[model samples]
Target: MSMFAHTETNARSRLPGGKALGGLLQRLGLGGRGLVIAIPTLWLLLFFLIPFLVVAKISLSEAAIARPPYLPIWEWDDGLLNINLNFGNYLFLLEDPLYLSAYLESIKIAGISTLIALLIGYPMAYLIARSPENQRNILLMLVVLPFWTSFLLRVYAWIGFLKANGIINNFLLWTGIIDEPLIMLQTDFAVYVGIVYSYLPFMILPLYANLVKLDQSYIEASADLGARPVTTFLTVTLPLSASGIIAGCMLVFIPAVGEFVIPALLGGPDTLMIGRVLWDEFFSNRDWPIASAVAIVMLFVLVIPIMMLRKAQAVEEGAS
Candidate 1:
């Protein structure tokens, strides 16, 4: 046997718990592969499933003035167990136009931001992927350089550029492009800019990773077949890179949907988003049950896109 296998067998023999665990796994018709899967399964159970269940429980509870700020769903009275679940929180969300509007606006903003990032990042990624090996690293470094700075600072920096008397306006005035400073700050436009700017790297990196590994022979073959460059790119390159595009868009969209800082800082009062609504319900209003309900609903809303992404990934894998 290999040294690694020998050591593993000896360790299992020496450790009673390991031996018992192995035996149990064997009886259950699981083996080394199951052991590998178990780590992530346990991690998700502990971190994701448990926390989600906790939030779901809270969503079914009533807001309270006491500690934890939510009433328990379960109670014991006269040695009998009683269970109460409040569905009013979800109903309240549906009844409130503000919540619905916020949800719509959040989705709209995130969607637009993701599209913009894809547009900007796709060319950058293509260039990087096609570049000489030595220059590729430098270009990639520049793409990710913003992350080296604090995210808040980067958003704040945009304020300096987007404000009426800020860098952009000043430059436009100096260049005689405009008569006066344009109002860009504290607007949905600024929020879009922030989201696109901050998440561009997320879009670019995935595309670059995908494009770099792409078989150039496909493109060359298309060209040899007398296909025009644009046609080849449209039919061949873009189709192959669909997975990367979806991944990048999802990365940008998912976080952008729940983004608090960008909207809170750059967006005007008119620019209502679900994240702001969630913050208000949780902190400003101290309505834990409502907040939990909003969170749960938002999660459900995100799950649709996540499921679509998973399906696309599965299809891609099957095709490969």
Candidate 2:
């Protein structure tokens, strides 16, 4: 009754010669819930769905000498629309061992990088989460301080540090650790280092968020039960933070899979990734159709991990 009275009063409070906004919204079939849902639906349709459709269309087309450099898959002839899709692009990708190797190598690199990030980030996140309240903020700020610098600048800075005559080598040489400078730049080592450095924060932040909210009573109960720290962590803390691990791994792995700059700049000729292949096909070879196909394939490849993450999240939510 009170809600009804409030609604009636709201409807009656419109300015002179003004339509009731709530009634107008109701007439357009857009209540609060409807507006919230419709806005995001329209946004996805306009952006993601539409762009994916464009890419899918181009992927079905053939390479041409025209300005856009790709032939349309659909055409009108004799007042009838005709569809002519060239599946050769996909066929070519299947037949090419290079694309297959690149895709596999990309997955391998991303997976390895994600694991390394997790190994390094988990301890840091744990420390921060367990830190005294007075010092936690400062530690967290330190963890995130690297982001204040430009990412490109940070990557370039690593080049200076990893080069043959770079700071690392100079320091080592001065200390008589080695006579020759280490071959760090333009190697798989450099690529791994770059990926770990760049994505470490991504891994840490999620783990911290998960860890900070963990119940201390669980740890205390395990201690009272005479469990060692390692056992307690493995049996209790680790299980509780599984969601963070999944979240962090997904965050690091997804972007790392499609990373171009890190591999292009820090990796050697042997370190061929799908991202580099896509870049070469599009800009270097001017094969827009093939590039679109590569992109589509990459999108499909990423879908599995994304679905797994979603499933994990759903299970976690249900359990909670």
Candidate 3:
């Protein structure tokens, strides 16, 4: 036996069930390395894959109010090793214009929010990248500090700051800016602020990491070639930092599409985000089938952007 396999067999012998499995693997010459990989693969299949499959199965079933979900999901007529499925929930999804519009709006909002984060984060990242190493750590820490707080707590804090009788309104009133408090909280403005604040760290870190690795020589080389700042940035800096921009945008945009807390806390009733709608379907209505359909749709919606980001990142990496 190989040293590695021998070592793994000896170690596995100390454990209970592992000894038998390890001996079998040793006989098959897949003792350590294969087991290490197989264990995680099996774990993911059990925990993640099985749950997701269950949800998908439930999504395809008719809406039910009963206590238990069945094995076949659609019809549990057959005792075992049998299944029945339907597409009624997805058809219902097709008929709902409100749900469709919410999905589109969610995409637009996430896209715009990600762009805003990129615009703001890029400069701060650049500054941090250019800073002295000692100072860079401090600046990066400051950028990351807010992330230490609970995400829901941050959204709640926005409520206190943007509410009619809250900090901003009170300050404005005290300064005689208005006769009454502005209705800022539970508005789109509040939603945007909450989204931006919650996701800023995700935006900044990737950009900072990417920008810091970039040599100063490129920028200096462009300057030496008589390229103006704007020209150099457009030609060189932007292209080089393309991966960072893509990374940061994806990190924020994907989650923001499915964001429930910020919208629930900071948005008006009029702002009908899909996340809130999905939440209501599962919790308030107890409609698991429709909820599953919503989840499947959300998953489908997210796949497009994720694919786009992955393609962009791969291209950027290839170019680098």
Candidate 4:
């Protein structure tokens, strides 16, 4: 064969293999993208969606002594779908003063705690953000270093500090500040302390993230125009950090509203949070349907704040 014919033969032989390799690579790329999407979707379906569906189903059910502990609302009868939903669980929540009070008190506690967290966190975050470049990382690390310890351990430690005979009371007594140990443990005061300590970082981190990126030129410009520090903060820094404020407040408030651990551990016997109620109904009373109803109602209550946060974030992104 001539040189040109030999070259043509070699080209034809390689064409199919090249095409196959390209097809394989394309298939792998598509598969990788699909896998990335599938993993999170599957995880949410399993953990969140399915669990919520189960809770919803249970909420519509009736209390029973049977194996699963609740009577099903749906049944198949005569080739038709039969539905028997007992809405009394939801209605009962409205009729019961206990439920109403618990919800209101939870809102109050969460709101107060969030406000306190913001007041405390904003300063800490601002200071951290304004620190020297080399020291900023160390300050941030110190803020987050508490997470290195177990949360349960931290809360337990607070118990030792807040108890009547705890270190704080003893120190105060020794210093002649009081005749006896002041009542601190198992009170609303203790609950607030535990919550603030536990969630302060949540409030600070978001504020820091926002403040660190703030343009210092605005402050300088405001000062140049005869704006006082407080005025500058109110008009410039505060407005710019509104997104962080919203984010931090949401992080603190949402979880605080449904908080079980802190209130259960530190709050008084009269402390009636919705979370504690839900826990009692589920475990103590074994009334799963009522617990589910409470949970569903809580979710409905939270939807408003969640939407507000989403809207704020969207607006911030748009402004940026």
Which stretch of 10 consecutive residues in model 4 shows the poorest summed lDDT?
311-320
Write candidate 4's Cα lDDT for 1-320 as tens digits: 69999999889787868667756866877455776888899999999899998999999999999888999898888998889999989999999999999999999999999999999999999999999999999999998999778888899899999999999999999999999999999999888898899999999998898899899999999999999999999999999999889988888899999999999988989989999999999999999999999999999999988987787667656655
Whole-model alpha-carbon lDDT for candidate 3: 0.85
Model 4, global lDDT: 0.91
In candidate 1, what are the lDDT values of residues 126-181, reduced to their tens digit? 99999999999999999999888899999999999999999999999999999999
Best by lDDT: 1
* lDDT (0 to 1) per candidate: 0.92, 0.92, 0.85, 0.91
Candidate 4 matches the true fold with a TM-score of: 0.87
TM-score for predicted model 2 compared with the true structure:
0.87
Compose the digit string of candidate 2's lDDT tens values, residues 110-222: 99999999999999999999999999999999989998888888888899999999999999999999999999999999999999999899899888888898999999999
Residue range with the least summed lDDT across 10 consecutive positions in model 1? 311-320
Write candidate 3's Cα lDDT for 87-115 as tens digits. 88888888989789889878877888888
lDDT of 4 at 248: 86
Better of 1 and 4 by lDDT: 1
